[model samples]
Target: IGLSFVPDLKLANSLYALGSCYNTIALIYTKLSDHLRALEFHHNALAISKRIDNRRSVAQSYNNIANIYQDLEDYDSAMVYYERSLALKTEGNDRAGMASTLNNMGELMLATNRLNEAEKFFLESLEIKSESGNRAGEVYTQNNLARLALLKKDFPGAEQYLDITERTAQELGLLDELRVNYELRIALLKELNRPADAFRYSELLMVVKDSLMNREKAEALAGIQIAYEVSERDRQIAFLEKEGELRKSQLALRNTLIVVSLIILGLVYLQFRREHRNKEQIKTLLREMYHRFKNNLQLLSSVLSLSARELTDEQALQAVRSSESRVNAMALIHRKLFERKDEARSINLRDYITELITYLIHAYGYHERGIQTDLSLEPVQVDIDKAIPLGLIINELISNAFKHAFIDHQSPCLTVGSKLEEKATLNIEIRDNGVGMRPPAERRGESFGLKLVNMLMNELRGKYEVSTQSGTRYVLIIPL
Candidate 1:
């Protein structure tokens, strides 16, 4: 129809219709797991939508294209398009569109495993929907937020959010909300370990689904009657000709779809290769950085050692040892990076920590007479960025306790351990079998190193408590 129409008479409308058709077709391809074909149709829709100068439609094209990328798990590409869509929505001041874009952004964040940012965007959209009395959209966003809470194991919060969606949907008779509400309620119940409640909601979900099918069948019957009446004359006279045209169109469409699929796959391959190269470059940069870093830390460690040699005073030796311990902690990270497999962002925490402890014990002479460092380790892999700060903090605390806490002692022993606590929290315990801390550690001339350790602990969003009877014990709780 668009091709048959006069360009001057319906140029904008034809372009808009072409874009809509391509977008719809793209979604079907995406659902059928043909991502490449879906991408081609998405581009086609984008072209026509831009031709028509419809900003909202162009934004929609960006969103649909992003959806295909999301399905392929190409988060970087998906994010690019989502930002494009958001920019268009903002430029147009489309409140409803903005709300939708926020929801999409939240979903993309969720996919990338950034739960905090996802919650913020989802709630932001919900707030707009609720204030504008867009109850339907509000229920949709609430449903998404509820699922998010469930994913985070926040069952109570999920239930609370679902309750709001349920009340709004039930009060206003919004069937779409009811469908999602029933299914999500079942999921929340299951996550809460209430199987019976989950089963009951599941039954309700089926009932809702059946009712929707019946309603759709009834509506389709009416639509079919109208369509038959409108096309009766043409249907009778040109039936075989229309059939031949339809068959030829189907064949051509099939061929076009195949070509589009190959194009999309080619594009995906190119994208993957580019990202692989980028990751490799980043790894090389990191390794070079660590090499330089190790050199600097060694220089610092040498300075501290020479200072201790130059000064025979006990107090000055303790200060130099403390600084050396800090340098060693920094040096350990560089050593581990070189030893690790070629990758960015992921590190085996257990291996890294064990190597670090062994290095520290050897460096500080844990096996030496009258000195023993006991470390209890378990399997734990934390992102290196987080683990680096935490390892340094541990080093600082242990060095301080080993120095002043065991002053003039017959023998000295230090222990450090980390355990996985409830709700993904990491609990670290560092203790020393030595003279306890000087009473009112904050008031006395405590080492500046201790002050810095406390600051790093705060930066980790960790909670720390100390106790001393025979020896000093420090407990730290940090959530991952």
Candidate 2:
């Protein structure tokens, strides 16, 4: 019906509406678990969204397609779609959408038994949900956390998470989340050898299931009623159109068009002036926002530093410091943007990386350890989206080297280099003159740092290779 209203199918509004319709149908099929049909509609939605230049819809289509792939157990495909969705959402600064995609990715990681990676994604989602005051989303993440804890055999931790989730889910009237909480509760009780409690939860689970079925039936009936009403409204419109056949005078139409054109021209001139002022205002606001963001990150880094200082366990302190470094890396990007006086969105990679290495050197006490630094980088500019993740990747590689790669080396040296290859790819090398590091395959199931690196690499659509012959040499190839 919406398509019929469009006299020209090539119009932007028509294409955007068609994309929305496709998205709606795709989501409906997704809920029905019809993977083939869902993917077909989602791909159509994605194509139309791209044609209309509707980025938000494109991100949503990607996320919906990822959900279908995940249901079909195509994890690799799901991950790729999820990453694309996340990148687009991040570009738009859509925090709510980002949280949703993060939660879905966390579930994918959990299903694959990458527990540590799952926890990180879950925590990230939870943090965003909490900050956005999304109580329902926060409860859902807590339930995921409970499931994660159960998998790790941390019964007490699982119970703590379930307790919070159950209470919050009920408070929020989140039926789906409450059902999930009940299911996890039953599992937790079974693991604890409390058959009676497990059985009690099983009964409650059935009641919730029945309630959900009734809610679904109600929604289905409502949809049917809406369809009937729309049909009747269309018939009435057709009847009214047949009854009244008034025609307009061609002279009046021509006069109206001339007046409308004059009005549009005047509005266009006013719009031009308004847009210029708006652009200036937006730039000023962006700089101020960047400054605030950088300051907030610095405050977070300080808190992490203070927390690390208070920690007694070496491993725990090191973990806190690693997190602090990651925060610092992200903060650096915003700081650069804040300091830049131009409207250019790209940051000079040479200056950014050189300053980053210098900070890391002091932060890790490379000088105190008699460690030598070698920095070689060609001038390249990257937008904030790529810069933040690249900065984190560099931080992790260099920080890992400083902490572990130089355990017993007499003459420690770190080499950080980057160069543009044929004006197409950016080749980055981080090498150390210390003990060789383990390959990704060996530490794939462990190492939070490596998990983060893999995720960031995916975000950048980059490839990497590790050589452990002389020491640890990480060669990252990122397309420009």
Candidate 3:
């Protein structure tokens, strides 16, 4: 009829009618899963629509083509055609068409694991569908949103979305949407631990599947026979035609394989070189940063020493020296980090304590003071942030033990040990065999260093207890 009326109707109207007929036939072919035939008819419709300058028809053709590619799982090509359809639909201000295209794009995004982008598109499509009174499209969009919510583990949100989808699908008699609604409800019920409810939905899903299969089988049996016969004839013709061109195709395939192999080799070599360069760049940058940090701390320590020498007051001089020691303790951490081959942001606590104790013994002149040290540190790793404060606290406690704890004892002994406790906590004990802690009132005047230790412990988010039963024993517990 369209062909018969081509001479009577206006040129544009005749072309549009022809395009519409081809598009309808293409849709039928798509539903029958004859994708090659669908593609052919869609391309024909697209050409006629373009010739007639019918923007809406052109967009429809693009959408049909995109759906075929999506069914074929050629997602890249599907995306290209979908975007083209979207641009044309937007230009024509076709809200319904825009909503449909947006839903397709959302499904593509969801399949690609672009969850956030999929949710955005689904929401926008839902708004458009609702405004246009497209209840069926709205239900589809709601199903997409429900699936997205499930992916995010937002069970309550998914339930709400699915409820709306189910209500809409039932009211409108939309069997396709209802099928998806049943499936999602089943999954949601399972997640909520309602096995009985989930089983009911599962039974409904089976019923829907059986009904759909029966209907499809009835409609498709004759069509499939006809299609198979036609395809067989075409295949025979194609086989005969290909027989003449067999040599050419084989030569082309060989050349293509050689080119692809070379391209793959080139890509592998480039990737290897790029990864190697990136690794080298990161190592150089880390080493330079650590070097600069250590130098800055050393410079600060030198400045503190000079200032301490200038000060005449004994109290002020002692304060400057204490500050310098704390700075040096932090510098030692960066020094070890720079020297180690492992690029981890944590340090070995045992090694750090060993080095720190050696430094303290030499600084306090305890070598000639008959001071015996027993260090038992477990092999534990501490991050840089916690390590700094922990190092400072240990420095203060050990320094006080040497200076104040052993003043009256002829044989001085200091013991430090660390062990891993339950719940990934670290327990450290520092004990000195000397005079125990003083009374609170008497220690207040000389408690400046002890106050610093308290502040450092707070920074570490740790708790400490001091016992003076036989000698001073400070136990510190820190969570990893």
User: Best candidate per lDDT, number?
Assistant: 2
Per-prediction count of colliding residue pairs?
A: 0, 0, 0
Q: Candidate 1: misplaced stretches above 4 Å?
A: 1-272, 306-317, 344-366, 441-445
What value of lDDT does candidate 2 attain over all alpha carbons?
0.79
lDDT of 2 at 380: 87
Instruction: Write candidate 1's Cα lDDT for 1-480 as tens digits.
Output: 212222322333445545655776777688789999989978988987888788899998888888788888998999899889988988998888888888988998998889999999998888878778898799889989988998899877887788778766655555567788888888776665555346545655665565557555754665455445434533443465566654544433433343344445645754565345434444454465566566767898998888888888887777778778777876776677656666443456666666766666666565564576677866767654456668778787776675567777777877878788789998888888888876784556755877777767765668889998789999988887
Q: Per-residue lDDT tens digits of candidate 3, residues 1-480?
A: 223222332333445555665776788788789999999989989999899888898898899899999889899999999999999999999999999999999999898889999999998899999998888888999999999999888987898898778756655555567689889888887886756346545655665565557545644664455445544544554575577744534433333333334435545754465345434433444455566677878999999989987999988877887888888888888898888785455789999999988888877778777688888889999876578778889989888887778886888888999999989999999999989888777755757788878877775668999999778999999987
C-alpha positional error of residue 215 in candidate 1 after TM-score superposition, expressed in Å: 55
* Cα error of candidate 1 at position 458, Å: 0.9
Measured with C-alpha atoms, the lDDT of residue 33 in candidate 2 is: 74
What is the full ranking by lDDT, best candidate first? 2, 3, 1
RMSD of 2: 19.7
**Which run of 10 residues does model 3 get worst, by summed lDDT?**
1-10
- What would the per-residue lDDT of candidate 2 be over residues 338-447, giving only the tens digit for each residue? 89996445688989888888788788887676778788988888866468779989999999998989987889899989998985899999999888977767764768
Give the C-alpha miss distance for residue 154 in model 1, angstroms: 23
Give the range of the ten consecutive residues with the poorest summed lDDT in model 1.
1-10
- Which regions of candidate 3 fall more than 4 Å away from where they truly are? 1-273, 445-448
Model 3 error, position 407 (Å): 2.1
lDDT of 1 at 328: 80
